[model samples]
Target: MILWLTVVQIIVAVAAGAFCLVAGLVGRRPSDFSVGALALVELLLVVQVVVAIVAPLAGNPPTGDLLEFWVYLVSAVLLPIGAVLWALMERSRWSTVILGVAALAIGVMLWRMQVIWTIQVA
Candidate 1:
């Protein structure tokens, strides 16, 4: 993955976390605003998926535990999609909790990506 792209994702994740925290505190559900924020992070993740696929094709296959990397990537992307769906169905503060979970998952995924990258480099 491109380093700058990871940085951008970090920023997006942080913002999403803040928004989710506020939404949780205020007892809110997903709206255009919350969904829009998640969309920004999702966009970054899509770019990451593209780059990750291309990198391996360009002779940069991951040297880390390959299964771990793939699992983290797939799991991270799925969380937000699930959150969106759950939020739509719940229509309550629980929806914000779903977003909070997504935000937290993103942060964990970011760290896991770094670990996988470092393992490859080492």
Candidate 2:
């Protein structure tokens, strides 16, 4: 994974998570802003997926276990989708908090992925 891309993903995920968390704490429902923020995170994950695929071809394969990295990447991609679906169905403040948690989880997973890509020794 690209260092800059990873950094950007982490930043976006944290920002989205914090935004939803604050919204929930303030008793806000699952609004467009929260959903949209998750959508943006999802989009970045998709981009990261593409980068992960092409990076190896471009001579930037990960230094850690490929299976582990892929697992984290796939889960990170699915989390926001699941959270958004849950929020839509539940339509409550707690659902917004769930979204925030999911985003924060993705951020942590992204950090692990960066480590797998650049630091770990397979």
Q: Rate the local accuracy (lDDT) of all candidates.
A: 0.78, 0.97
| TM-score of candidate 1 against the unseen true structure | 0.88
TM-score of each: 0.88, 0.99
Regions more than 4 Å wrong, model 1: 120-122
Q: Candidate 2 lDDT, tens digit per residue, 13-60?
A: 999999999999889999999999999999999999999999999999
Using TM-score as the measure, the top candidate is 2
Poorest stretch of ten by lDDT in candidate 1: 113-122
What stretches of model 2 exceed 4 Å from their correct place?
none
Clashing pairs in 1: none
Model 1, span 9-122: residue lDDT tens: 887887897887688779887788887777777877888888888987888677678678778888878878888888788888868767876876797797778678655653
